[model samples]
Target: MSAGDYPQVGQGWAFPPHWVRPVPGPASVVTDHGEERIERSLQVLLRTLTGSRVMRLGFGSGVDRYVFEPRTPDACYRLADDVRRALLLGEPRVIVDSVEAVAAEDADDRVDVVIAYRIDRHRRPNSLVVPFYLAGAR
Candidate 1:
C-alpha cells in the first residue's frame, strides 16, 4: 500500500516517517496521513530558514541572510519578505497567506514572526510562529 494508505500512529498531527524513530527512541515510524504531509512541510520550512543558499545541492532560499542585520522596523519587514519568499520556493504544498514580523519588547535584537498559511488540501488556515534573536547584531 502507498504511504497514505497506512493508518496514522496517533490522533491530531501525524509524524512523518523520518521524524519518527524506531523502538527505544520514543518515536515510532508511522503512516504519512494528511497531517504528516503538513508536518513535513513545517519541518522543511524550518530547515530552509536555518540553512544558507548553496548549502544544499538543489534547494536554496534560506532566510539566514537577514539574521545578522539590526532589528529595526525596516529590517523586520525585509525579514518577513525573505521568509515568505523562502517558503514559496522551498515548500509548494502550502499557500502563504501572510507573514508578519513583530519586534520583541524584551530585547532589542529579537523579533517574532507570525506566519499564516493554507495547505492545498483544505481551506482552513494554519499559523506558525518563529522567534529570532540576533545576538550581537549590528
Candidate 2:
C-alpha cells in the first residue's frame, strides 16, 4: 500500500524544524508524514541521551556513552545492543529487525550504526544508518 493508505501514521513537525516559503505565501515550518515521520522520530530517539530530558529522564538511548570509547568489536556490539534496547523501549510504532555498528572505511573514530526495522502496519522494511563518532578514538 502507498504511504497515503496509512493515515494512522499521521504527521509531525519536521525534525530540526526548518522553514520553507510557498508560492505567494509566508514561510511555514516543514512537516513530515507517514514513514518519514516515523524515521524522524527514530532519529530523535537515537540522538537523545538518557537523563537529558528533564521530565522524561529515562526516555533516550544509551549509545552516547560509547562516544568516548574505542571502536573495538566489543564496543561496537555493545553500542548496537544499546540501540536495539532503546528502540524497543522508546518507539512503539516500529518492530526492530536488527542493529549493527560497523566501522567507517576511512575514519577510525567513526562507526555507522545500521538499524533495520519495519513500521507497524507497513509491509516494506526500512533501514537507517546513524553515524556515531568516538571522541576519544585516535
Q: List TM-scores for all candidates, in order.
A: 0.64, 0.88
Runs with alpha carbons beyond 4 Å of true place in candidate 2: 1-3, 135-137
lDDT of 1 by residue, 30-52 (tens): 54545456656565665564434
lDDT by residue (tens digit), candidate 2, 7-62: 66777788888999989989998888888888889989999999999999999998
RMSD to the true structure for each prediction, in A, is: 6.1, 2.0
TM-score of 2: 0.88
lDDT of 1 at 114: 83
Model 2 poorest 10 in a row by lDDT: 1-10
